[model samples]
Target chain A: MANLKNNRYLKLFTSTFKLSACTFGGGFVIIPLMRKKFVQELEWIEEQEMLDLTAIAQSSPGAIAVNASILVGYHVAGVLGALVTVVGTVLPPLIIISIISLFYKAFRDNPIVSMAMAGMLCGVAAVIFDVVIDMAKVVFKKKRLLPLLVLIGAFIAVRFYAVNILIIILVCGVIGAIDTVVHEKKGAEVK
Target chain B: MIYLELFWSFFQIGLFSIGGGYAAMPLIQNQVVDVHPWLTMTQFADIMTIAEMTPGPIAINGATFVGIQVAGFPGAVIATLGCIFPSCVIVMTLAYIYYRYRGLNMVQGILAGLRPAVIAMIASAGISLLIMALYGQRSLPSDLKQFDAIALFISITAFIILRKFKPHPLWVMAGSGLAGIILYTLI
Candidate 1:
């Protein structure tokens, strides 16, 4: 039993490490890969369970990759498994970024490099704008007043008012919680 | 002390990153760029580009890059840990609660509310980055002469390509880099 448990932990670590190392474009890209590894391949988690875990991961704070890894790891083995997976998931980027950082001065000073980076900066802005548009579309699809208000309000607060983002996030979370409780109460009343 | 600050800053980043990597951008900008002056807007844009190109989560990549730039290798380790620490605790607790009580209506509700806020945050970050990329400054320039028409053209073209063709991001990055070399360097 001990050997089998150790083997499981090791497998969990290796799987996450490999997945994290290979994944690019971040965010939702990792989800399908993870579902493939843990569900289709390992069969450690059921299909519906993985979906639920994904929902939890998406809704909660932090990187979805790390959050999903933690939940899957905990579901498989417990706290130790969670720890193992988190470390595995983090190590790849930590290693990659560290190496890139070493070249910081070289990259910063080279005019050619700077020009390329400047161009890439434009691309980055486009990508971010795409994200905003995509997400806004999702929110607007729901056709709710509060969500729409929150969207516009949050934008104005950060862009114009220069409100601290920390405060904005906290207030949004609180608003979300209250909105939820009220809806639940109303739901119960109607039922 | 720098290490402590790095760790704490990233800790807050991870905690409030609520939606995902993009949503975390405004929070990160507030901390590293505005609050601490650890990174300039230009450097922040560069890091975002690198983070997008690299493997793994953008938050983790950004934290590691900033940490190393700020301090060193040890800083990188510390910052990365700080960034993921919240995910560890939060995910575990939520996982346990989820299993214990399967109904997640509240979580659903919160997510619905958060969706719009996260979008707004991304838009805010996008605008800042756009200003930096097009005008070559952190904010809007005092004069129109500072604007780079080439950069704006590249950005608009990139946006249109992304919306229509939906090519891999790597391709887009490469295309933009090539355009930069041709327009700014070779010319």
Candidate 2:
């Protein structure tokens, strides 16, 4: 809501860029880092806003980091903020990928590098696990049955039927929307 | 023509995919494997494996690797750009509207529904990863396939132990890589 240059835009942008470059696992890994810098250090955004944006970004499409940047940018200073945040987020991966590609053969099978990558993989799985658990507690509310059934359906589709993912998302979206609308109508009627 | 196709394909992936790269995995596999046939499923699986082993998001790696294979360096560039474009537009748009309607209950409620769905998708993915890791466990050939079980065990145990310890994740991964090498040579 203020002029970009005078405020903390540059600092926030650089911090996110570095996080993007360094973070191996996408989604949750980059998210906590972004929260640390934007929400915590600079106070650019609040905690609730971060959670809300995560929901929006997940549903919207595109790289989580990019969508997130746009949301944070939009929330912070409007159109210009969105532009700066995206540029900041893109710069890291763009630069790093270019460097990696240029030296691809040389680094492709380096043992130490390979070992480091192996470590990153374990960390990634753990990072994603943390995200799944934290969000599950909030969303599913420790439900005993319905959420478990939904989880079972998804696993069956992925493992047994080998169903197309888009189909799964479509079904879930429709079901979720119906549940939300019906519940809302019931609430309004009670009032 | 080639560059345009590369861009459009990833653009489509970006425009529709949510919950990040992991969620996009199945559709991406389809685009490259079934629809386009630019890469075989085996190669695609291998790419997924490598992507996991490397840095950055899964979709980005998919775009980069698939694009390079199809149309060389330029293809990778366009595809990556296409992949992130939707986020740029959508996030900025939402940010603008979110200000005026910050306290709308309906918006908040829709989010509540969507949250559970996203978690479900992540759960399914975790199961898929477990299956992949657990593959060699079931079909072990007495002594020949023991390495597979070891990796799985290390992954599971390291996952548990590392959760409590404050050491960097890279250390755990590097240790596994060493284990992979040692297992490979000795076994």
Candidate 3:
């Protein structure tokens, strides 16, 4: 039993570390890779369970990759598993960024590097724009008035009013909670 | 004290940065750029470019990069810890609750509500970045002469390619870099 537990922990750590180190494009990319590793390969988690955990990971705070790892780790081996997974997931980025940072000054000052960054900045903006459009489309597909209002209202608050981002997030969360409660009550009354 | 500050800043970013890595952009920008003045807008854009190319969450990458720029390797370690600390606590508790209760309506509702707001936040970040890329400034320039037409052309072409073809983002970034070299350097 002890050996099995140790083996599971080791596997969890290594799997996450490998995924984090190799995968690019962040959470959306990593989550599918994780599902492949844990579900199809290891059979540690069921497909449905992985899906549920993914939804939870997406909804919760922090990086979805880290959150998903924490949930999976805990599911497999409890608290210690969660700790191990989180460390594994974080290590790759930390190591890679630290190495890049060492040479950042050189890159920043090089005229060639600066021009490339300038062009890459445009690419970055395009990618961010794509994200905005994609996410907004999902919200719009629901056809809800409150969501549309919140979307426009939040954008205006941040862009023009300069309201704090933290405040905006908190207020949105509260509004969402209240909206859910009120709808649930209506459903209950009808039923 | 600086280490403490780095830790706290990234901790808050982790705690509030809901949705995902892209959604975290505005929050990261607010802290490292607006609040602390640790990085300029262009430098922040460079970090975002690097984050997209790298193999990890942008939030983690951003924290590590900013920490290194502001301090050193120790700073990078501390900032990365601060960023993931919230994930460790929040995800574990939420996972426990999820298993205990099974279906969670409140979580679903809250996510639904947040969806639009998250989109808005992402849009806000994109707009600022667009302004920076086109005008070479944090905000729009009063005079049109400050605008970089070549940058605008690159961005529009990139946006069209992304929307139409949907190639991997790496290709778009690499193409842009090559374009930059040819247009800005070689020309």
For the candidates in turn, chain A alone yields TM-scores of 0.57, 0.73, 0.57
In model 2, pairs of residues that clash are: A118-B173, A119-B173
User: What is candidate 1's lDDT per residue for B1-187, written digit by digit as tens?
Assistant: 9999999999999999976677898888898999998999998988887776567888898899888889988998998889988888888998898777655777656555555665676577678777887887678877867788888988999889988986655567568777877788655
Candidate 1: which stretches are off by over 4 Å? A1-89, A96-104, A177-191, B1-87, B94-102
Error in Å for residue A189 of model 3: 4.8
Q: How much is A128 displaced in model 2, in angstroms?
A: 1.8
The C-alpha interface RMSD of every prediction is: 5.7, 4.4, 5.5
Measured on C-alpha atoms, candidate 3 has an lDDT of 0.80
User: What is candidate 3's lDDT per residue for B112-180, written digit by digit as tens?
Assistant: 666576567657767876787788767777897778888999999999998999766557767887787
Cα shift from native, residue A58, model 1 (Å): 11
How would the candidate models be sorted by DockQ, starting from the highest? Answer: 3, 1, 2
The DockQ of each candidate is 0.43, 0.32, 0.43
The candidate that achieves the highest DockQ relative to the unseen native structure: 3
Mind giving the per-residue lDDT tens digits that candidate 2 earns over B1-187?
Answer: 8888888888888887866676789878878888787888877876776565555667777788787788876778788888877767776677677666766665554444444555655555554444434443223245554344644655676667555763444455446556656654555
Better of 1 and 2 by TM-score: 2
Candidate 2: regions farther than 4 A off? A1-7, A25-52, A140-191, B1-52, B58-82, B94-102, B127-187
